[model samples]
Target: MMNESHAGTARAALPLSWAKRGLVSLFDSALVGGRPQQRYFAALGMAEDEIFTGYDAVDNGYFAQQAETVRVDAAACRRTHQLPPRYFLSLGRFVPKKNLPALIHAYRLFLNANPQSETHLVMVGAGPEDFQLRAQCVKLGLQVHEKSHIPERAPASGKWEQQRGSKPGVHFYGFRQIKENPLFYALAEAFILPSLYEEWGLVVNEAMASGLPVIVSERAGCAEDLLEKGFPENATFTSISVRRAGLRSKIRRNGFVFDPHSPEELSRVLGLLSSVAELRIAMGRASRVIVEKFSCENFGRNAWLAAQAAIEKQRSPAPAPARGELMIPPA
Candidate 1:
């Protein structure tokens, strides 16, 4: 939600007295998505000690394990196709907001800078932007991954179709084994998502959970929230408390966050990630750590706690009569 829209201003006009009430909250961010229907309960009006945020997150454990499985499968896929050892992975519909067309331009720039490098750009998923994506690939003298896919119909082989075309740098492998897609995370040196405008790009969460270093658009919600927790210690988390205080930190060094409007900036990030293997490993580890905090289980447990807190508030006894005031009880 790019703040300051007409509706947002109207909603922000909500009464200030709502702040002065008994409450519990589940706001995602402090000020994002308008003034928030909760106002102070959304973390602004409540005492710092009482605010809660039931923000959304992906299943870290599930995605992580799937990534490990794909890690093994990655080798076979790479060998069978003779794909490049160093490559970047992207997953999303070919929508304009996803900026795949711009990503292709950035990929071209990356190739121009690293002509001798064997790095490839393999983007998955399909949408209305498919034809232009392919045209851009061919226009830049980039090779395409020829695997026909119908959005619904199964391929005759009952597997993600895979074939080779005679181009080198960019590979647009449309739809593949829908179930085994997480393997794409295992096969990449890094993951990139440079959206034009995204309230939240969940693929960022999946990619990070899969142990791939990420480069997200600054405008994407996960760009900040994924990095919000910074680095977690090497211990198992038993629960997620309702407070936003514990996990939130200022030290976010997980991955690159660049301007989506600047193709040169995206190209620079791609080039940097492509050239530095050690950097990718370190950042990818940090990504794994950060994502662990935002796991599906953690999100659920924390939300349960928040619900309990609100119920407790609902059930609490009001203060007894003070001075001349009369006491009243619920009938």
Candidate 2:
């Protein structure tokens, strides 16, 4: 969207050459919205060096430290949030783009598929679409379901007992303090971001940092970066090719990417996460491990390199080679 402004009337007076190069930060995928954005920049007369990939990143230290801080009182959070031992979590603004409706629908689907699975859905965040989401929840029978009171006390095992008669449903906690988010991630069995079209999602990074497995849409920028080639358990022994080979395997993936915004796909993925504890642990580890490669430090370094390349390109005062000519293989 920032690129669109460069072509705006506000910048009409600036010479094209004087524009030099601009940096656009992109998240982890080369597909989805990536290709179109690149074409836009190229059409705007940006050369390869002029536009550099600055990936989306977050403070790993902050999440890591917060995770420890929150873990101290995790059970309290679970009770306060009315969360089960295992639940799928989605956090984002209540906007259409975030696709909260689809998530709710998928949650319904999950419950229908696994009527006995006590797993729940927790959505945190408030937005313009708030009323509609609540309405949808009500219509789906999630909001007004029958409930048998769960006892306030914990069992001998130390885990909270499930509500005997209440149906599993979405727990809508409107916007929460950012500081409390780590606790939410820590409590969740897995994190889900089913955005219809999100260029980059920082919450995915945060969830990964908190060591929760994630399920994001194919269009999410972080999906591939966090999912495709996450940190190898043994880099010394396992080749990247081997890792890629097992991307869809439950043992290897941090999450699964779904297509074209379907509730069924999201539902199926959620059901998978709900069914297996081992899968959740492995994927959560993978997400956290992969995120290290996309740290804020890495973003800064990549941006600096791009700027230097652009500055040098601008200063060279030489004619750029023709596009068609440059693509030809040399004899």
Candidate 3:
């Protein structure tokens, strides 16, 4: 039912019990949208009789239209320098919940294992927790690049160079305008979202729409449905073991599972992605196919239908109580 837990403290301040009851009374089918969230709603007194889940869909048409608006004008994008062969792009705030540390560790491993690989990682987004992450990346012997709003000059502190070695390729593009993001996405070879947990990774879909291969963590809710439904038949599913559970479980395990705690595992996956061009193209095509199904038009239609059904059921009269004698006397 569009659980709002992601709002965290902000949601907790509201009158959740009243809100739940009000919502239940208003709709026929209460569709719980995220993993772990259905249970949260249940705890708020929502019953299985009223709750519905299992099918998670988004308005893909809206996103597709949004994707179309990306600027093809290279001049607007400001390509100050040539991009590396395999650009590892990550777009998320430098927050712990976004799991930047794990990604950093995995990236270190990936670089160490393939020193000759002409790959560069571009992280977009900044937050309070960025300093420590920057320090860690430097300590690990990986190059770091910091992009700023004032493009005329670089940071005077020399911190970026100290942490990233001389002529670092890694960049922190401060805050590009929203319209300019597609330009950055256009430059990348592949998209990586190694979050420890995510309700639905919109960026994964966005990257796929941009025609880039994606490497997302299993914990992401979108991985269960979006990736599964969209993944190419030939694209290899990492982390899932068919030897343990055969094809069905393997399919279920595919895109939705990964060891976020292990950098080595992440490195291995990225390594495989970088090493094989055919695999990347196949996976990219599969991602596009899957994303098309989730278009905004489809999501709006389904959401409307689901809402209508719920309203219709809610409007129907409740069955009369049985004519049994009252168990307790009226006060």
Q: Decide which is better by lDDT, 2 or 3.
A: 2
lDDT of each residue in 1-331, candidate 3, tens digit only: 4442322212453455456545544445555444444555566555555554433454444444444454354444444533343478988778887888888888877777777777778888888767877788778876766665434564555566544343324667665555556656666767888877777677776777766677777766566555663335675545243233232232221232455676777777767667666657776667677667656565555566657766776688566445642223333
Candidate 3 regions exceeding 4 Å error are 4-27, 31-78, 81-83, 150-157, 162-169, 229-231, 234-257, 317-331
With a 3 Å backbone cut-off (N, CA, C), the pairs that clash in candidate 2 are none
Error in Å for residue 295 of model 1:
1.0
The lDDT of each candidate is 0.62, 0.64, 0.60
* Candidate 3: RMSD to truth: 6.6
Ranking by lDDT: 2, 1, 3
User: Candidate 1: global Cα-lDDT?
Assistant: 0.62
Best by lDDT: 2
lDDT of 2 by residue, 154-190 (tens): 3232122223444566666667778768877888888
Give me the overall lDDT of model 2: 0.64
TM-score of each: 0.69, 0.72, 0.72
- Minimum summed lDDT over a 10-residue window in model 2 is located at 25-34
- Model 2 misplaced regions, further than 4 Å: 1-45, 49-51, 144-166, 229-252, 318-331
How much does candidate 3 score in TM-score? 0.72
Q: How high is the lDDT of residue 76 in model 3?
A: 40
RMSD of each predicted structure: 10.4, 9.7, 6.6
